[model samples]
Structures are given as C-alpha cells and as structure tokens.
Target: MCADYLLELASQLEFETVSACDTRDILEQLLESLAEHSAVTDIPVDEVVLANLHLALHQLDAIARGRGRPAINIPFHVIEGYLLHGFNVKEISELFGVTRQTIHRRMNDNGLRKSDVYSALTQEELDAVIGEIQQSHPHTGYRMMKSFLQARGLLVQTTRVRDSLRRIDPIGTEVRALANRTLRRRQYSVPAPNAMWHIDGNHKLIRWRFLVHGGIDGFSRLIVYLSAATNNRAATVLEAFIGAVNKYGLPSRVRSDKGGENMEVAQFMVESRGENRDSHITGRSVHNQRIERLWRDVYIQVLDQFHILFSNLEREGMLNPDDEGHLFALHWAFLPQLRRQLAFFMDAWNLHGLRTAGSQSPYQLWASSRHHEDPDQVEADYGIDWEGPYGFDDLGHQAGQVEVPQVQLQRHLTEEDMARLPDPNVHFMDAIDIYKATLQQLMQPRSEVDEGGSDA
Candidate 1:
C-alpha cells in the first residue's frame, strides 16, 4: 500500500501511522492495513508492504539514544559488507539491529563513503544488460528487474529499470506493470520467529526415489531445515521434524499438507503444544505457501541441473529405469552430490536478500526477530532453562557451525551393488569432481562390474 492509503487507514483507525510507539503499535497498524486492504485486494500483505510498513512504524525506535555522548562504534568490515551489498544506511540500520544514526556515525568514523551515482554504468550499457536478462526472465517487471540489477551491484533506480524493461520487452513489461498496479497488498502474520512453521515434502525428484522434505519459519521466512531423503516414509520426515524441534524448539504452530508422512509430525505438534487444535494445520499441498514457495528456488538453483544430468544419462545408452544396477549406481553417485548442493543452496538462500523482508537476508530477519524472552524470563514462564539453540554460544550469539546429522539413505543395500560400486566420497570433492568420478565409475561395463563383484 502507498503512504496515502496507510495515512487514510490510520485516520480511519484514529491513530498516527507515523509515530507508532512500539511493536504492539506496528502489529495494530498491520492488522488495520490488512482489514482495510482486504476490501480492495482480498489478499494478505506482501513482502514489499511488510518491509516498508516495518521501517515506517519502527523509524522512531531506530533513533539513536544517549544523544549527547559519543556514537556507538561498529566493526568497519560489517559496515563495508552492508554497503557493498547495495543497502542504504536506513535499510542497513533497520536490519543491522542498530539505529540509523549509529550507522551514519560509524561510516564517518571508518572514513567510508557510499556513492549514489553508479558512474561506471552508462544508460546504454544498462539497457543492453537488461535486454539480456529479459531474454531469460521475460516476465520480469521493473520492481523485480531493479532487484536483479541491485544483486549485480548496479544499484540503479526503479524508473531507470522500468525504462530499460519497457524498451527491451514492451509487451511483457506493460502486462506485468498493469498487474502490479492492479494487485492489492497481501501479507501473512506470525508473531515471532518460532511462532509458526510451514513444513512440506517436495516430490519433484520422487520419480527417481529421491524426496526433499523441508520447513520455513512463517515469520522470518527462515529455512529451518531442508533435507534430501531416499524415501518419504513417515518415520523419515518425523526424524527431520524432531531434529528441527531439537534445534529451534517447538513452534507455536506447525502447518503442512494432509499426507501420511506428516501425520506423525502433526501428532507430535499436537502433543507438544498443549494438545490444541491450532497446533497442527493440515491442508492441500498447494495451500502450504511458505514451504511450497521453496520448491521453485530449489529447482532454479540446483534440482534442475541434476534433472538435466539424469535425463541426459537416460537419453544416452546409460540409464535404464527398469534396471536395478543403473538405479543403484545413480543413488550411490548422485545423492551425496544432491545433498551437498542442497546445503549450499540453503546457505545462499538464507543469506540472499529478499525484497519482501526489506532486503534483509532470511537469517538476518530470523536473528533480529528472535524471541524476546530473557533467560530468567524463559525459566519463569516455561519452567525450563533455554539458551536459544545448539548453534548458539553462551553469550547467545549464533556460532558459525552447528553439527548437522548425516543423512542415512533408507534404501537397503544388496551385497552385489555394495561390492561392485566405486566410492565417490573423496575428501575436498567439488560437485564436478564427484560427478566426473561417479560417471567414470558408472561407465565401466556391467560385465566388468559383475566380475569385480564376483572377484570380491
């Protein structure tokens, strides 16, 4: 929604949207916006609205305190990282868990200057670049195009991006722009980071006996866990669910589809959350927006490449779906590759800025929106000691690494395939190295492989 609309809503609600005192006011404003916009768009608030409204409501909260004293210093490297990532001082300050004045003071102290003019990129050069991007993402409008350009460190204006897109692909640009103008703001609500989680299984690779089960926090959109598994059995997904609960603790609610695999998790959520009806929600897979949304990212980032690789193997004389040997060979070769790729994707995803979350990375949002309960408060309220998660140190800072349990493929190994297949778990192996090693191993004649097994 625009400022005019927000102002109108606040006028109707009899509150000043500009000077919302605290998070409670933010929530009150958010609900007012939702109720007002529902009449027009019939949808919830979206990311852009979420981000802009938050920065607006919390503007006062982000003011520097102790005004007469020296500015609080921040590490130069962290500030540099934010600046290089194309974040302005205000957005960085909001997401950095600090006041805007502090960020400005630190920039001055560190002798750093962020330039608004991207002097090196000429309009003609940007037009050519955007034309190329349109060749792939034809449906991309100026807003998303701006994000794409920002990601490339261009830091161009939305109006400039619109000019480029309109010139490059006039029809597509007009259609998307019209849609944007007409679409109403939509948003989902969750109180805190662990307030609710949307969990689901991805069946894109199920044709090859591969399944991906994952969860995303509803509030921060943080990925709690993303796993590659050989099967979608109830026990398997339950183990993944339990593992996440062990890390982040029980969310106030768990949302998933009405599949058998989620039944156990649903029961666990119900039992864990005071046996309440609202603890676990079941519905069609399409309705689980948070986790369902992740499938697209996985496909674009990693899953599609693997799909092409396997499809090529099938097109050639190599892979036969009906053959056990070929399937087993693929399992031994590629599952590890898939797991590692997913891990990398997970990291990149968590760190990648979202236009929705006000340009904060998912991890950044999760960290900043963590539960407000102090240690003593948590003990008093829940009658249990809490120290965040296993990834946290004593000071409550998240450590760089947390031990992730190794995935144990549920596929049973016959004695023959075990003796015949070459090991691909080389130390310091990259995806290419793993693929090359496994393909070479798989190309060995079936007769030779059998003979090797017989010899063994």
Candidate 2:
C-alpha cells in the first residue's frame, strides 16, 4: 500500500529536461537569476496557490529539522520558484522567507573560510606515507595513520590525513573511545515492581554542570526519569524523584546507593511526600541495595551517550562559531527531544536487545511469570495424600530447623576473582581499591578488615 502510494505520488511530479547550460547558469547566478527569470516570465500565483505550496513546503522543512539541519529564515515564494527552476537562489530565499541578499550573506557568514593549503604533508609525501601504511598496517584508518605519521616526524592533523585518504581511496573514520569495554551481562529478574530498579546520574557540563537522574524498572526495564537538573543538589534529586513518582505512581520501593546526600534526603519533607500524604495515602520508602554493579553500568552508558552527542555536535560544527552560548541554548532547547529519544532507546532495549542471562530482554520475562500456579487445587497438584507426604505427615509435623545462608554475600571467596568485591559507599576510587583488595585476599589465604566499616 505504502509503495503504491509513493509510486503514484512520483508519477504526478512533472519532469522537465532542463538544459545543462540552463542548470549551470542557474547554479552560477543562484536565486538572483531566478528572480530575474521570474520577472521576465510574468508568472503570477494567487494566495491559495501560495498557501498550498507553503503547506507542502512545510513537510520538507520538517524533514530538514529532523535531519539536524540548521534553521534559517528566508522568503519561501522566491525559493520555491527557484527550486522549480532547480535549486536557484531566488527559490531558496522564498522558502526561507528571506531576501536573496540576506540568504547569501547568512550562507557566507556560516561557511568555513579555512584555506585548503595544508602545509604538513605534500601530495608526494602523503602518497609515500600511504604506501608505508599499506605495507605495514593495511587496514588502519586515518586516526591510526595520524599516529603512525606523528611517530615518523610527520606533523599532520588526523582530519587532514583523513581528507587526503578520502581523495586517494575509500576511507572513513569509526569514532571509538579507548576506554570502552565489553561487559559480561548479568541479568536480574524480579517477580514484581519494587523488587528492584537501577538508578544512576548522568553528569555533564555544557556551560553549567547538569545531572540526569535515570532509573530503570528492574522487572519491566522501563526507565523512570527521576530528574534532570543543572545542579546535583539533594533538593534537585528530591524534585526529580517527586516528578517520577507523580508520573509512574509510587513503586513499592526504590533502590539506590547509600551516598551521604541521598542518605539524608527526607522524602517525607519533600513536596511530593506532603502531597501524597495529604491525599491520605501511604508512600513507599527508598531501599538501598548492593547493586553497585548495575549503577556502574548505568553511569558508563549515560556518560558515553553524552560524549557521543556533544562530540558529534561539536565535530559537525553545530556549535556556534562566534559565541559558545549556543551550546547551552541548543542543549536546553533540545532537552525534551532528548528525553523522547531516550524513551525510544529504552523501548528498544526492553524489547529486542539481548541480555547477559539467556540473552533475552527483560520485557520477555516480564509478560510471563515463571512460578505461576493455581491456588485452588493445592492437594492434588502437590500429590500430598490424605495423611500428607508419607514421611512428613506420618512423623506428625515434628519441629525441625533449617539453616539459611545469611543474606550477606561472602567476600573475597575466590583467589583469582578477589577483585570483584563491591564498595558499600559507592565511591569510585574506593570501589576500585576494594575490588583489588578482595582479589588479593582470594588469591592468597589472608583476611583484611572491611574497609567500609573501618574507614567511614
């Protein structure tokens, strides 16, 4: 159906065999020539035709915006006419609702004025370098090439090297951070909401420091936006929690790190707490857990995304050339859009993304319960006779004891895996130290005092 509709629409577009010279002439003079051509043609359009054209043009405008294309105000009528004549300046101006002179001036203003005279490597030198690369590391990209050249006393920017390679061969750069690692998946399944949730902060400094409070439902893996703020104050966190509670309703509980600030955050004193109590309903309290493993993963993901977003924006020159103020403005203005995009990502993660355990998404198990059983037919299902299971029933329910493994996880259990110990305080440096200490203890038959209790 969609394909047929697109084909039908394509058939309606009038095609013209524009002369090559005409196209070149239009390109040379741009909109100035188009306006001149229109004046000579004496073609007049009414308001209705103009309005319909404007509406149609809006669709394209939306596409451009979605593509991260910069916005400009230009005259649509002239630009539309120019496009009809094959992307002439007059039509572009009309589309932007700006004059031809204004459009041209703005284009020049934003355009890169850098000279192409790269001085570091001449064409012959570049060829020789490429030959060496092909001989040594044939598969290396421009970044590797840049590093290789630097070691050989060639002062060439990676960008310059990349550009040169593009001219000589099909070359592309795959942006990757050195610190990235593939983490083994550890899945946790909770039978109900409040069983568990992952919480972490994504911090950034565009102009001012900002933190995004993110929490993922353990069962559904649905993300709950606790808050996003310019400051990482206790109050800011509280406000975010309030917002999340208001949206998702209070979960039976929340699990987070035992950071000093969060430990002191009295949710009842917060506005959301008062409001919920005023409605005469009880609210859930926050729960702490040894889920540092999950928080570490969450923090890395948030920081990675932040770096990728801004890095791309900066590299693409989406940042303002004159004043850096545009960074803050652009980021804040796009905050809502970012949130929506995050939601889309979360959905993808929950539905299709593989997990560490059984390689299944959280959403898969969420829809079906593993231990579901009918309560009514307890006796027959259990296969308990009238006297109960032979041994237990005949013995007349003797009082017996069963030992339970205390919920405390054993510390430094294995020699080689001692470094896996978790820190109670959730401090990054402390966590690393604890991990190393545990690994040492596991590898050697030695015991150390729990630093968490002794230090703090």
Best by TM-score: 1
lDDT of each: 0.62, 0.41
Candidate 2 lDDT score relative to the true structure: 0.41
RMSD of each: 15.5, 24.5
Per-residue alpha-carbon lDDT of model 2 for 1-456, expressed as tens digits? 222332344344324244333433333353354347447755432332344334434544554357533354434443333322223354445544558786666545555111211235677778777665544344445544554454344546446777766655553333222222343333343455433344544443223234455666555555555344544555556666555544444543344443333432345333322332221111111121222333333334334455455556567765432332343343334444345434433443444323343433444344332222212211111211122111111124321221211112233234333333333343322333443343343334233334532454
Encode model 1's per-residue lDDT on 1-456: one tens digit a residue: 133345555564455444334444755666686668755655555433454455444443444242333334455676676565555788677765578888878888767777633435778998998886555345555655665565555667556877877777888777876876786544555567776788877666655667778888877777788899877777888888877765555677777766778888888877876553467776545456666556776676567767776777778877665555455567767788788767655655665667667767676677556634312112111211122112212234422222223334344445765554556564323443554555555566667766866887
Off by over 4 Å in 2: 1-191, 204-208, 242-249, 259-330, 353-360, 370-456
In model 1, the worst 10-residue window by lDDT is 376-385
Reference-based TM-score of each model: 0.53, 0.31
Candidate 1, superposed: residue stretches over 4 Å from native: 1-88, 91-98, 111-187, 242-250, 267-272, 351-364, 370-456
Model 2, position 68, has a per-residue lDDT of 35
Cα deviation in Å at residue 7, candidate 2? Answer: 56
Summed backbone clashes in each candidate are: 5, 27
